[model samples]
Structures are given as structure tokens and as C-alpha cells.
Target: MAEGRRVKRYADLIKRVVSEVIEFKLNDPNKGMVTLTRVKVSPDLRIATIYYTVLGDEKQRAKTKEVLNRSRSFIRSEIKPFITSRWLPELRFFYDETMDYAERIDSLLKSIKNDADSEEE
Candidate 1:
């Protein structure tokens, strides 16, 4: 489904907050190389799903998630000032696995292409 203008606006707000504000403010050592990929706000704008990715192994990813979970309240507090809405949406953190899936698909496609070329030869 197409995202409405409101959702797009909220997503942009979330992106800015996460990148320019929250990333530096978070003091947790476990929060490794985190990047906010996207945000999905509910239609009513009462809740937001923040999708993020960490540049590290599985262990680091787990640590990053834990740190984010622990720091949720701090993040919300920091974000409140930037948002003009009467009610701030509850933030929910989720790992964006799309990047990993894309990488796997690309690798598989390359392998298939190589095999096809070999068969042709």
C-alpha cells in the first residue's frame, strides 16, 4: 500500500531525530554502528515502528537491540521536543533484515549467472 503524506512526514521526522539527535545522545557501548533505515507510523499516529540496522556480527546486532530497548524512554524524551503533535507516538525498535536479504539475493543471482555462463561455454 502507498504511504500517505502523513506517514511520509512522520518517517522523515523520525529519520532526522534518529540520525541527527538520538545516535549521538545514546551512551550505550553496546549500540554499535546503528543506522535508522526507516520508520512506519500508525495511521492514527499513536505508535511508530523504527527499523534499524547495525554494522556488525550477530552478537553485536543482539547487543545493539538490547541497548536500544533499554534506551527507548530516553529516545522518546529527546524526540518529544522536535515533534509538534499533541501526542507523541510510542516508539518500537525492530531490526531491518531487508539489507541482509538483499545481500543474499544478490550473491545468489551472481552465482546463478556464473553457472549459466559456464554452461554456455
Candidate 2:
């Protein structure tokens, strides 16, 4: 649907804004080395799911999430002026664990490959 495309476009726009504009521009200590992973917007573009990853342990990740949540209002206000949409999508933060899962799978495959090579030898 055309609406879905618009929503996706908005999601990408938000991702770019958060990464290039907010992350780089804002000097927030509590952000904690956060990386914007992905964004998913609803069909109506009223709600957005922003996936992020933080480079640290669980506690640090939690802290970063809290910091981001606290700054949500400010971020919304700051981005509103730039966006031309009638309704700014509500931002929701989620931790992206895909990288960790991929890493584990890669390591397992490497170990299996090493075993195969050893058997061949």
C-alpha cells in the first residue's frame, strides 16, 4: 500500500535523523555509545519502533535505554520542526540483539569448519 511506503520512508528518515543528527550532534553522556540499528514504522506512520544497540554490558545497556527514554520528548520536539509530516511518529526504543546472535552463529560455523579441516588432515 502507498501508506505503508510512506511509513517506511518516515522510519528511514527518523533513523537518519537519530544517527546523523541526534547521536552526532547531541553531547549526551548517558547515551553510552549507542548505535541506531533499525527502524520500523506502522502503516499509518503514527508509531515507530527504533532499534538500537549499546556497546557495553547489560547494566550499561539498561542505563543507555533509560537515558534515551528520558530524552525522547526532547528528541521528538527537536525533530518535529524538520519533518513535514502532519503527525510525527511516536518513537519506541528497542534493543537489537541480532548482531550478537549472528556473531555466535559465525563462531559456531568457524569451529565446525576447523573440525572438518582437522578431520581431513
Candidate 3:
């Protein structure tokens, strides 16, 4: 349906805008290598959840998350010019775990292969 497409488009737009804002506009000394993985916008267009990953340890991830949360208002204001919607969707951030899951799967597969090879020997 057209509504679904609109929501998807909106999510993509929000994702790009947030990524740029975080990459070039955000000014925080405690933030680390924050990477925006994806954005999900509700069908009602009332909430936009942004998922991100930090290329560092748990402490770095936590710090980045804290920074993002603290800067949510600034980010919203920065993207206001680009948003055509009458109401700005609330921004919620979450740490993306897909990368970690993928890495774990890769290691498990490698271990399985190694075990099979050892068994063959």
C-alpha cells in the first residue's frame, strides 16, 4: 500500500539525516566511533527508532549511547528543516546487536569446520 511505502521512505530519510547529523554535526567529546546501522519508523509516523553500533568495548558503547541520548533534542532540531511532516517523530536510540550476532555465528561456523577437519584426520 501507499502508506507502507511512505513509512519506508520516511524511515530511509530519517536514517540518512540522522547519520549525517551524528557524523558531521554532533559535537561531543565522549562519543566514540558511532555507526548508524538502521532506522525504523512507526507506521503512524510518531516514533523513529535509530539503531547504531560503536566500534569499541562495552564502555565505549555505553558512552556513545549516553551521548546519543543526551543529544537527541539537538539531533531532532538539526533534522527539522529536512522533515516535511507536520509533527516531528520522537527519536529513540538502541544499540544494534546484529553485528555481534553475525560475528558469533561466523566463529561458530569456523569452529565447526575445524572440528570436522580434526575428526577427518
Alpha carbon deviation, residue 8, candidate 1 (Å):
1.6
lDDT of 1 by residue, 1-121 (tens): 4559867898789778966655779877788999999998888788889999999999999999899888888888888888887788898999999999999999999999999999999
TM-score: model 3 vs. ground truth: 0.96
lDDT score for candidate 2 against the true structure: 0.84
Kindly report which residue pairs in candidate 2 clash with one another: none
Native RMSD of candidate 3 (Å): 0.9
Off by over 4 Å in 1: 1-3
Better model by lDDT, 1 or 3? 3
Give a tens-digit lDDT track for model 2, residues 1-121: 8777877788888998877655766668877888898999887678879999999999998888888888888888777876887888788999999998999999999999999999999
Better of 1 and 2 by TM-score: 1
TM-score of each: 0.90, 0.84, 0.96
Please identify model 2 stretches exceeding 4 Å from their true place.
none
Going through the candidates in the order shown, the clash numbers are: 0, 0, 0
